[model samples]
Target: MRPQCDPSCFVADHLKKVPPSGIRRFFDIVCEADDVISLGVGEPDYITPWHIRESCIHSIEQGETSYTSNYGLLELREQISELFSKKYNVEYNPESEVLVTTGVSEALDIAIRAIVNPGDEVIVVQPSYVAYVPSIIFAGGVPVTVSTKMSNNFKITPEELKNVITENTKAVVLNYPNNPTGATMDKADLEAIADVVVDNDLMVISDEVYDCLTYEGEHTCFSSLEGMRNRTILLNGFSKSYAMTGFRIAYALGDSEIINSMMLIHQYTMLCAPIVAQLGAMEALRNGNDELDKMIREYDRRRNLIVDGLNRIGLECFEPKGAFYAFPSIQSTGMTSSEFAENLLDDQKVVTIPGDVFGEAGQGFLRCSYAASKDEIQEALERIETFVNKT
Candidate 1:
């Protein structure tokens, strides 16, 4: 018999400490169940706008199947630069400040890895994207989780920010129009957090993946705030905004110095984002605004429908001003998020993720994405209503 070593012995120690994504369990269960009305996944049901898909097909027909430059195609970068300037009044140099990546997920990983040193504490606002905490850990950094309460509409307060800072702190991760809760921070809220960021002299990774899906007051780009652009690694993408989830193209914009360092890590790991995806992304940027607006309008309609429906059904749902999720408190249901979601899936064939999967503060809540079709959203609401009534 051949001598063998344990696989765990070869695995990176940091990764061994990180937990698997809590969101995926429901997704796998739904995939195996029949007649499931899934509001568990965060992806938009809309196909990549026809024009964007056609452009990708065109790129393939033209045999443009090569890898883009490690920094991504120059034209795509230039368009990204322009998009930021036009929408948020923030200027980034296409050549130096933008680093196109595989997705916002990849950009998040790269940002954490580039700046976080061993023993560094990265302050992470929760409940947020599942990747934030684990990514910090995987990069040899500790994640200091700060709970953004439902009482404040889940916005991260300046006081909360100040309390989490320490000498070991190196960066803060902000996601708004946030996940799970669908909360957004406006300029005033962001201005306050900016003060904390600047006073502490910490770097920030702002994930703005859902920036375009906002349904309330303006979505303030954190980098646009005073004294933030220099320290902010702004991450945005074509996935949620353009319904181009499969494209796997996103970009990070930041100080040239920081972007340069991220580029070094990116080039070695990813080599380059796919050329066809970049071309399609460029087309989406150039021509997809009208389509995006249409999608947002649909999401807005569903948002109102679901939020109202959940509240009517006895769940205490706060108004979600951005993104497409309705985080309804399940405390009144007399069950934990996991129990409520599991029973709903088993009895009603409706799938929604338990909110605690996002963070500890997410306990006693459930994240129901309205990014599904209007029919699906309406039906899911009805099923959820029935489940609530029976319980």
Candidate 2:
């Protein structure tokens, strides 16, 4: 029998307009190909440090697998509070001002929902992460994009911030030690942007997932600035720093009122993050510094290797100051970013991300992650050179 069709369908209107993320398509294609060297993925190639993994197993053995309190385990929240205080010079009362989430990804979702009403404007700087735009749209807020240029090293200037602010601006999404671009804002840059933020009475959603992975300088927390703490929702996780991407644990810190509001949304949406993962994250916070230091040293080594190798191959790349990515200009190859990525994979069996996948500002470039093995990076660079020379 034919199914009866109704004019009123089940799918939400927002779902119809939201396009699938461009980053995933190349990832899927690369997984299906043989002998491909992938520098496309942003995740660390290393396994989660042994001790961190052991903590989760130990928790399970102790029969600690039940759902935690709706916000999260008190122990984990307290650990997060201590870590933030010690590392970033930010203070938060764990019980009232922190919410554990299923990765910085979910923390961002909850923040968007909590602060942005329908038709509100959420400002995002370009060449940023993929999730910000869709998250804003899903929350019924309009995304106002401010394009940043490579000439500026991809950092958003205060003048740029000033131009974007409007009465409807609810929040600005800040991704530092940024993905894809590998840009980090220094203290001066933060102060300049904070001036605009403060004057406009705008909120900041600071995504600092790559905070611990910085290379050139120490990461400066926006929340640590004077008067900014009350207006910033700081998002961080164990994914990049501790090589715990699969742990599915992250946290958000903000004013108590904002955190409480987010908790209400989080409880209804997800109930809680996995209890076992929270245990893993707790151990990561408590005693994972030595392992994290070792990992960061290795990433720094790879970062220099890949950047130098690409430059030697006649590809002009900005020396990344943070994160594990190299955003290299592929304009010399006479191909668009998409064409360069596709041709490199098809012809050389080397996979990288098209910069335009990030945004229009990324059109003439490609993002190569240095989170792979040293040998893998060397091989990928050679393949890229071969492809570039021949084409």
Report, for every candidate in turn, its global Cα lDDT versus the true structure: 0.92, 0.91
Clashing pairs in 2: none
The TM-score of predicted model 1 comes to 0.98
Least well predicted 10-residue stretch by lDDT in candidate 2: 7-16
Q: Provide the RMSD of all predictions against the true structure, rounded to 1 decimal.
A: 1.0, 1.4
lDDT for 28 (candidate 2): 94
Model 1 collision count: 0
Report model 2's TM-score to 2 decimal places.
0.97
Tens-digit per-residue lDDT, 248-285, candidate 2: 88999999999999999999989999999999998888
Best by TM-score: 1
